[model samples]
Target: MRPLTEEETRIFFEKLVKYIGENIKILIDRPDGPYCFRLNKERVFYVSEEIMKKAGNVARENLVSLGTCMGKFTKSKKFRLHVTALDYLAPYAQGKMWLKPSAEQQFLYGHNVMKSGLGRISESVDRYQGVILYSMNDLPLGFGTAAKSTSDCRHSDPGTIVCFHQSDIGEYIRSEDTLT
Candidate 1:
């Protein structure tokens, strides 16, 4: 792990901020030594310190975080809401996709939602971008990667529209101590 210089943090943040919007209250808690980007100091993203520092300039950078980790730290690490970083910019979020009740079940089960499953979405969203998946009631379900462009996701026939959820509120109790 390394630390992010002020410059690396700026570039990394600029790209993501566009998806979220300039108004979202994101702060770099500590870009160096275990990178932490926080939304209002509550929801936090823990990505690698090195990756944050090394990138001179990268666009549409995947907001990968601790949840994306797949090793021993998986259990100990908390699920970070990389997508919800744009929640504050909900009004301006271009990559939002809402699902029907049936689709919500599949999404929570770690299945990709096909285009038909999408009940609503924003048109400005691009392909392979981070998107927020919402329940029928408009409650944020979690975040995912767009499998197709927003236009394609809307009318591109039956196919995966959103990637498997990367992080959700449910993850708080998962891979760790549970009510059980």
Candidate 2:
């Protein structure tokens, strides 16, 4: 697949926001890492297939509290998750993050701590702020990163407010020049 044009990425995000709702919480993985989430209603939802598929809308609305924004579910038009306004859980501690396009980028690795027993061992969607599509011939120097022992660390794309742990390279189509 070829790299997505800026318009294409924007359209994709618009569709996601429409389908998932603005206030909905989203957890997702990066191209090659763990997971992260966005419980804050004001934050832009980061959609990665790896994390979204794992959780698959296990949580919803008020009770939904927290769950991974698996890309498998959100990236696809077929995913129909329960859409309801989110009431941020004080205990979980939520906030909104932002993102934009740039030449350089970074990724982090970590897991969600919103569930019982699991303690959010599995990565979720809070990580990603957004995507930065570059010309097919200009890929970011280190768009990808690795986890330190996989103990759940917060990864942030300094350029963009978006952050994620796991890497979801499959989500984006790469071309020879795009990342070069």
Candidate 3:
């Protein structure tokens, strides 16, 4: 694995900033020890410095992966954040949505969240903004983009889509064969 180039870092951070906002600083300067992002076979990995050091000794050709796979850079150079990055994004997410128990299953099945399934939403959420979805009990389930602003949601019909499905934890099982 190798460090991301300046252009790659900018593209990656732009996508990440949409979900985590300025909390990117906290990720870079964490109290738990230094961490870094490395690229291997187009996949970005978030690894602790200690592990990174050990990984450095491995031949690049033989190092299949190292650290958490944050996401991958598509052939078009666009970065796509993976569900594997959900744990890091959840804590720093700027917009959050909570689903009702009844709707939890629907979302896990890869359906967009409908107004009827929404239990609560952050006041600052805006149309098309990135949002982290959680259960009513506060379990982070996935991440998606808001389909409507907070104000718009209040007046929308129950069947209206509130959040567009992107990646979710359920994919871990449902698409296990396809995931890297």
Best by TM-score: 3
Which has the better lDDT: candidate 1, or candidate 3?
A: 3
Write out the backbone clash pairs for model 1. none
TM-score order, best first, reads 3, 1, 2
Model 3, residue 33: C-alpha shift (Å): 1.7
| Model 2 weakest 10-residue run by lDDT | 112-121
The regions of model 1 sitting more than 4 angstroms off are 1-4, 11-15, 25-92, 177-180
Model 3 C-alpha lDDT versus the unseen true structure? 0.93
Q: Model 1, residue 59: what's the lDDT? A: 36
What are the lDDT scores of the predictions, listed in order?
Answer: 0.55, 0.27, 0.93
Q: In candidate 1, what are the lDDT values of residues 5-96, reduced to their tens digit?
A: 45544555555554565534443343344544322112234345555444323432333333122111123333333333434434445578
TM-score of each: 0.56, 0.18, 0.95
lDDT tens per residue, model 3, 1-180: 899999999999999998989999998898999999999889999999999999999998888777888999999999998888998999999999999999999999999999999999999798999999999999999999999999999999999999999999999999786556
Model 3 ranges off by over 4 Å: none
Model 2 TM-score on a 0 to 1 scale = 0.18
lDDT of 2: 0.27
